[model samples]
Target chain A: MDALRITHVEGTALPMRGEDVDTDRIMPARFLRAVTFEGLEQHVFEDERSGSVAGDRAKEQHPFDNPQYAGASILLVNRNFGCGSSREHAPQGLRRWGIRAVVGESFSEIFFGNSVMIGLPCVTVSPDELHELMERVEERPSAVLRIDLTAGTCEIDGFTCAIGLPAAARDALVTGAWDTTGLLLARYEEVNAVAATLPYVAGF
Target chain B: MGKTLLQKVWDAHAVRILPTGQTQLFIGLHLIHEVTTPQAFDALRARGWKVSRPDRTFGTVDHIVPTRERNRPFLDLLAEDMITALEKNCHDFGIRLAGLGDDRQGIVHVIGPELGLTQPGMTIACGDSHTSTHGAFGAVAFGIGTSQVRDVLASQCLAIEPLKVRRIKVDGVLPRGVYAKDVILAIIQKLGVGGGVGYAYEYAGSAIDRMSMDERMTICNMSIEGGARVGYVNPDQTTFDYLKGRPFAPEGEAFERAKAWWASMASDADARYDDEVVIRAEELTPLVTWGVNPGQSIGVGGRIPSVDASLPDQQAVADALAYMGLEGGKPIAGMRVDVAFIGSCTNSRLSDLREAARIVKGRHVAPHVKGLVVPGSVAVKRAAEREGLDEIFRTAGFEWRDAGCSMCLGMNPDKLVGDQVCATSSNRNFKGRQGSPTGRTLLMSPAMVAAAAVAGEVVDVRELSAEVAAGAI
Candidate 1:
């Protein structure tokens, strides 16, 4: 795979206003039964969007259910989003649903790591700025939000806010160090050499 | 001037600093289970890569395995496919698999310690979030996603940033009936759910030091619920004693040398912490989560926390209260329960079973309350049955079953039917976490779950333990 470089992302924004949106709610445990993450986009927020109880998905009311937010590529969320479960499926589902970047007041550590690894840049903005941005995004649905990571700013029609990414994470996105799988594979011999000396490996 | 245990372990395992400034740390132990490993193994196959150190990796089948029906070709085709993929992947990769029917098979976290694979000073990684459960041994263990799991399978290392260590010190003695589960719940309640973000919690002080290895595991298992990526207790004599003569532990002289090294790896007496928070253990009571999140909890005798307009997460509190269908000021102890689950990687150990059995031995499960006890592993199952704990549960109208992560997230057959309210010993209380989207879960200790099963409502385990001791049944 080519090294990932995410310098900037520009798209219509989908706003989810809530604190501590957990992974279980992002992609319910029932949907996690699948062996692969394939076709999980349709099931994102399955419970909240469809109001399903047990495999029944008829009623629908959540914001994601609205056709207005269709094809939106930028996700706008509130504090401590993705706060529970270390399941990567949460990020994978969001990615599959076409989200390229997320601008939120805050993010859980694991969720941030998972999103960064998958080439989705999660930027943190001040709460006041986030609220202003969310209002602008919801009010002007036709307006495109531009998130320039290199410039460290999120801009829309009537709002512009400074966004923050950890320096190391930003470096990864800029230099393509985010996808280290190739780099890891390059050091195969060194890894095996270290493994050979460990007592547990030797004993086996 | 002294390094903390986390720093020492992290420094020892640092392979190099990556361009991203994340440490390319070597993983001493890599554990995998059925649910998360299939996609990871597939990722490796797609890259034409084989496991770098199969000898250092271990596999097991949990999450999707049925606890009651032990027969092959599981009724759920999806569950069967997942387990089969794990077995095939482990075999092809030359990794040891503790699959069903194997004596070593169990929850990845439980079996790692039981088989002596989880040792002090190790940097362990697993695909499951509860990997922190092994931190009870003083190891630096963290959960990884499937992609990271694939990374570990290919290179036996992870590129990760270091975490600041927060020392959470709980002093004094814990009152009777308050288990480690209650201690963690209380901590999460006091410190909001997101309080531990970007930090590794080092549980310390007299209270933590006095806890058994099992209790420490129970405390660390729920670190994720508090938004901490990892939580641990320093390895002590108790940790070494628990590992003594286990199936894979060091032998005789080697054991002595390993113990010395492990003891030396403990954080220094004068180690400086980034932050410290102290709690009086004597003041703690049995805790139960009152809302959808684990942090929204109250003591057994306490009422739900009223939503304060001054609180930052007011909307969050309101949302949780709505999802739970609970009034803010109502008492939690008498809340009705439709089901009671006494299992999970958190509280399905031998001691957990013994304590719950002590409360359930001569009692009948309340009518209309479905109770179930799933041991953490096959060995735990056999051990419980050997000690008649299984009999106690079965006779009390509880389904005493084989080992798997049953009803905890409910990937298997054991799930909450419809909007049933369950008193559970599992770690998470997230909405629909028990499989049914509308099902409600109350997180508590195993013995507390037993009390709920008997009373058909949440009750103080201390009250039941007192009654049982008084021989009033």
Candidate 2:
């Protein structure tokens, strides 16, 4: 019953189908001015959702802007989601905008790491499974989708499929150890010892 | 099985295995910049902790600094505030900062290697994704989130999951006018943007071995774009020669000792890898991105890809074509460009500037195109000016600007106006990357960007080089 343990996530899903949806598209660089990540929810996908890009044909029906997907806590996306930039702001914005978890075909390594650090689970499903989940969410935006990290399964409308996450990431999320500062600090002496052994740190 | 350089470096830096099955890895060097550190510092305060190893940390102001104006209290209040916060944070945390007035001030990635702070066999962490740029020196460096930034600040350690090593071998000599930028672009195009996920790219083969250290950095800088969190080259004579006598690098006997350790850290001849990819360098040409991502690119002589309904990435291609306002099957050459930017951590070093200057020496930018050349660092600026590269650019109708990541990400005032097509040397071509929401970006080599500026469109740099040799400019 630990509040921090994210063994399972169940909520409405928002489908945004696009490969390599980069961090810049998720949160534009202009909004990165503030020292804190506050108020980022209002600006998530600010450019795409608002059709700010000139001649952008796919701007009209951005899932973030669609009213049907409002309050959706799970985001379903295609491959290579969050591809460019190491900005934690992208995942922060998604989390703040009511996205608790993401199910995608694939994710960039940095983006995947950033999401886990913030306790936003990013699981990968097979292409077929992701397509089916996206189609289901589009057809029934209010349908509840459940992801169980411990069991590595995603269930929607009684259709069950395996989801993939790194074993370490799954353990961190299930044990509430995703915010790893304390876990890292527990071995502070060992860290210093390792640093001392490095030739570069000791100036050879 | 023999060990890859990644394995050796990882083993060296690993402190302990955490309870969650992740390794607690000690960071040898931590680089910080204005955009990502304010919150990280605040998090440290909340935890009642101090930076465990200030000596290992370095800070700089780059993302929000204006390349045009060097004055205090920047016109952009938010930019000014960011710099001020970094200044206060560095001072409070006892970390050294290369502020705007400092001669060493520049892009974090640029200054780290320039000042010899990035060394081989060490684990470097930065808040910026281009931290992979340091891996050119055979280091295990990767970008981290702000929370990990706080972790390194508090304990000089991070909970990290190990990655598999992928050996990307680019053999054969590069044809003239095909630069390191094109090599990486070709790799990204061949391997889908996400192809390198869960892997550390160990760049090898004859072509990589022959490249200068600066060129190696350019190749490593964009590894993140290919979804590899870490990328590196094995340390060799090129790496050691570049490090010797640099400001922060060890002196004389110590340097000799360090070089031995670095060379030993290289991957063994029989090192095992999870996967292997081989590319022929001679087959590559000057490449350019015509879509929203780095992977959506074509060679200078190739046409933009047409969207076929049955293709695996058809929807992605269609979306890219729609956002870029480009037609399918059109020749990438002669695509109109309104802006030309020759700067960024990817291609703003001395050799990059020299190549661009060589192209623009006797030519002028097209009247309709705005051209800029921002150096990567103040030292680079001074060096370029000393070589009179600035005069060459200014005379060629390109604005010679101060150091920083000028129009690369457009964190500063130098940006593309609405819908302007920019032929740039920056890494990412993500939509709105250069400040304008709809501004289009074409990623190319610096020489190609220079040639594009002169032609006011995309043109083959090899053809332009031939024309330049014929005195046709």
Name the top lDDT candidate. 2
Error of 2 at A17 (Å): 0.7
What TM-score fits each model? 0.97, 0.98
Candidate 1 lDDT at B381 equals: 91
Q: Score the docking of each candidate (DockQ).
A: 0.57, 0.83
| Candidate closest to the true structure, highest DockQ | 2
Model 2 clash pairs?
none
Query: TM-score winner among the candidates?
Result: 2
User: lDDT per model, in order?
Assistant: 0.88, 0.92
Candidate 1 per-residue C-alpha lDDT over A82-195 given as tens digits, one digit per residue, 9 for 90 to 100: 987888999999999999999998898888988888888999999998988888877877789998888898899856888999988998887777877766666666666655
| Per-residue lDDT of model 1, residues B1-473, tens digit only | 99899998887777777767888888999999887778888888997999987878999988889987778888888888888888899999999999988988888888999999999888899988889899999999999888899889988899898999999999999999999999999989888788888889999989999999999999999888788889999999999999999988888888887888888789998899999999999999999998888888888999987789987778778778877888888899899999999999999999999999999989989998999999999999999889988888999999988889989998898998888999999999998999888889999999999999999999999999998889987
